[model samples]
Target: MPATDRSVTEALHKRRSVRAFTGQPVDPALLKEIFAAAQRAPSGGNLQPWQVTVLTGEPWQAVKDEVAARIAMGREGQQPEYDIYPRELTEPWTDRRFGVGEALYASLGIPREDKRGRLARFMDNYRGFDAPVMLFLHCSRIMGPPQWSDMGMWLQSVMLLLVEHGLASCPQECWAMYGETVRRTLGLDDGQILFTGLAIGYADEGAAVNRWPVPRAPLGEVIDWQGF
Candidate 1:
């Protein structure tokens, strides 16, 4: 399916953290159009702090190779620029994270006891779930939490735009685990910090991993409507 004029609500409903993608390559012109529109995404104090490097073909393969080599060296090879999650995640947040993970594994038919199976699947993060393109997001090291929040908004905008264009994506913070490797492979300066990677392509909708039902909290649990 090609891009359509979709409503924001429709785009929201269509968007998913797609884990499987077809081999079909996305059109470069379409990608450029979507990203150009995404530049309008709101930022705090008009500071558009998000810096993205879109990769495909040989460049993307090179990054995966570097990360794979690092993975072979074990945990000691990791050089994360920042913590992907809080040191002590508690309560609802922890439960939510665990629930999604369990659901994903269940959909893949990997039981909780199958440690090796699960590990193999988890390692797929480095492959961008085999998506055709990888958008590596980074920002200046000097950017504070507020700017980081702005980056999140920008990412959301991009994802929604992708959905509207009949595309899919997965925002992988797991890339941050190999931050230094990515920086070196891309020849990024020390002042820049790798934040995350977005895998984009046509979704493999028939795949079990892509078909899993991702749950969301009810509005009451997340929203506070005192005025209403």
Candidate 2:
């Protein structure tokens, strides 16, 4: 079905963090159109602080190779520019995190005892789950929390746009774990901080990793109503 035929709510329901892709390349024109439209996403004071480096073909493969070499050498790549998660994550948040992870592995038939299996599966993230295109999001190092929030909003806009184009994506903060490597490879200066990577392509719908259901908390659990 064409994306234009789907409502926003339908797109939302269809969207998922697709971990496996068919390795099909998305049309460059479509990519440009999607991002151009995403420019309208709201930002405080109209500060369009998001910067994206889209990679495909040789450039993308070079990055995968470099990170793979680092993994093989027992290196941690580089010091992460920022924490991906809070140092003191607690309660229901931690439980939710653990639950999704367990569910993912279970979908792949990997038991908790199979540490190697889990690690191998995780390492596939560096390869971008075989997506033909990867986009690195970055912004000035000096940007504050508000600017960071703007980045998230822009990212959400991009993901929804991808869904509207019959494409799938995975927003990976794990890429930030090797921020320096990515920055250097892309020739981006230290003035900018790499935020995350988004893998975009057609999803491998039949893949077990893509078939698993990712649960979400009930609307009542997250939203509080005063008067409506």
What residue runs in model 2 are displaced by over 4 Å at the alpha carbon? 1-5
Candidate 1 Cα deviation (angstroms), residue 105: 0.3
lDDT of 2 by residue, 36-150 (tens): 9899989999999999999999999998987777677665545587999999999789999999999999999999999999999999999999999999999998888999899
Error of 1 at 130 (Å): 0.7
Give TM per candidate.
0.97, 0.96
Top lDDT hit: 1
lDDT of 1 at 140: 97
